[model samples]
Target: MELRLGISTCPNDTFIFMPIIHNFVDTSPFTFRVVLDDVEKLNGFAVKGILDVVKVSYGVVPKVKNKYNILKSGGALGYNCGPVVVSSGIFTVDELKGGKIAIPGENTTAFMIFKYFFGEDFDFIPMRFDKIITAVEEGKADAGILIHEGRFVYSNHGLNLLADLGELWEKKQSAPIPLGAILLTDKLKKEAKLLNNIIKSSIKFSRNNFEIVKPFVYRYTQQLDDDVIKKHIELFVNEYSLDVTPV
Candidate 1:
């Protein structure tokens, strides 16, 4: 049977997952299929048992621990990971006090990151990444927290970057934010070995063949060019990618 795999188009954190996922489908060809969505909806999908495997934030592991397993990946940690806070009026995390902050979704790492620094008292309006920037720009929110491609595109919207969560994590913990992880749900627990092999092989393929696919990555993404996306790919892929870790 073909399994359902979910994808999000976020950059930085998700670069590795793309290649690893491609490898699985390319290698098995007939046994796997993918479902795509913004991370917001994807998290709910993951919770509802809609996907066999999905890319999820490290911060999200704790919330879904009983329902899913956090797959381990190499080179994923110690990498600079964080979302940028943006708004027309709120200039800093400090300015967000008691105001509504637009979050990607409740289960998203972006939402947790905002909550971590802003406290639970702050109100968060859930929106997808595609809509979050606009909501903040149009004054639909006091401010917004953005992740993935938003990191590269927020400035174009005339929104100001209030704070860098990755930078904050590093200063506080003296390590890069444990940004994301590839997840395999308990529903697929019996297929762990098969799944792990496919992911590993795909990661290997992407690293070895990145030059050939540079155009493809660029084509699918915005106008960032191959170099920038390539940098993110290198940062996110490889030894850091994984299939599972102990809680």
Candidate 2:
């Protein structure tokens, strides 16, 4: 038998998963296929039962709860911080009401963030962060919400940051944004132990083999240099949990 795993290639996740994926496959009992897609498509895959295990945004969890289960251990919570909100100029979330905001995808924490802060009533145009910067710069939208490399390159596009969505959540609730997380199918609890072990082992292997995976991260991330790649690895892939966390 086989299982399917879905995920995003963002640096935060990429760094964390690099080691985990390598270790998971090597040490786990179940063999599986891996699907790397943007957060939006990835969420759909698992939600539709097209894939067995996948990564999903924290926000999307409530919407698809009946169909999926949160893996708990590796969730990307705000922990008093998350991706910041940025734009071409000074603006508040309220200012963007009815305006255009560039975002990653419906299943992305960034998109949920935009929705959470803006109250699902605003207009958001989904696109890659890099493209979001260009769209905002060209005055296509009132502002933009960035994720991935966009965090590092916002200034390059002549845009200024307006907020840190994660930080904002921390300030409000004293916890992380509870961003993206690994998920299991609704009845896949049988995977709890295996999934947990695989993630733990993957992280262990990556810590020792970062040099080998650095190129993979860079290649997928628009050829980011070693320094940035190393930093990327450092930022995400925190302690892996093999259990579900409480709400």
Candidate 3:
């Protein structure tokens, strides 16, 4: 069966699925029709139940759980890996109250965490994740929550960190932040283990063959600095990706 797979174009997502993209692993009876977009768009695909498999923010899972089941492999969950609030100039979280804040999407984990810490005081402007930093820098937004590659490159753009929501969540919850997750539609529940092993195999293959995967990661992240791309993969892709050990 051909499964429709939706994923973000972020380096980490691309890194984990590199082998599958290149058909380096044995997908067996399952072939994937991949669709790449921003995480928020992928979340929308999950909400609509349009894709057979999709990558979505953990924050959006509650809304989609009825139609999808979380896959153990190919998820983004780790320590110190959370959304951050950034501004063009230094400002405390309290100082930015009632100001315009750019967010990747209302359904994103970044926005959910942002709302948890900052509350509903700010006027939220939802846009594609890539546009947020530029929006804040141009004074279109008072601040923004940075996720994906933005978390790593915000400093180079002269953005100041207001808070690392991941760190805060870890402090309060005492567990790693659950960022993104892979979900298989409920119809595939019986095949979850089989599909998961294929994903794990693909992840393992990518890690062992970084040189081969590097070009694929770069294809989607060409605009990012080399160092940023490296850190992006290093930080987000870990043992948890192979199988998210419950915290």
Per-candidate TM equals 0.81, 0.86, 0.97
State model 1's lDDT. Answer: 0.66
- Over 142-231, each residue of candidate 3 has an lDDT whose tens digit, in order, gives 999989888888888899999999999999999889999999999989999998899999888888999998888888873557888878
Task: Report model 2's TM-score to 2 decimal places.
Answer: 0.86
Best by TM-score: 3
lDDT of 2 by residue, 62-148 (tens): 777887777756555535336667776666766667877777777777777656665776677887655777788888877877765
How many collisions between residues are there in candidate 1? 11
Top lDDT prediction, candidate number: 3
Q: By the lDDT metric, which is better: model 1 or model 2?
A: 2
For model 1, state the Cα shift of residue 82 in Å.
1.0
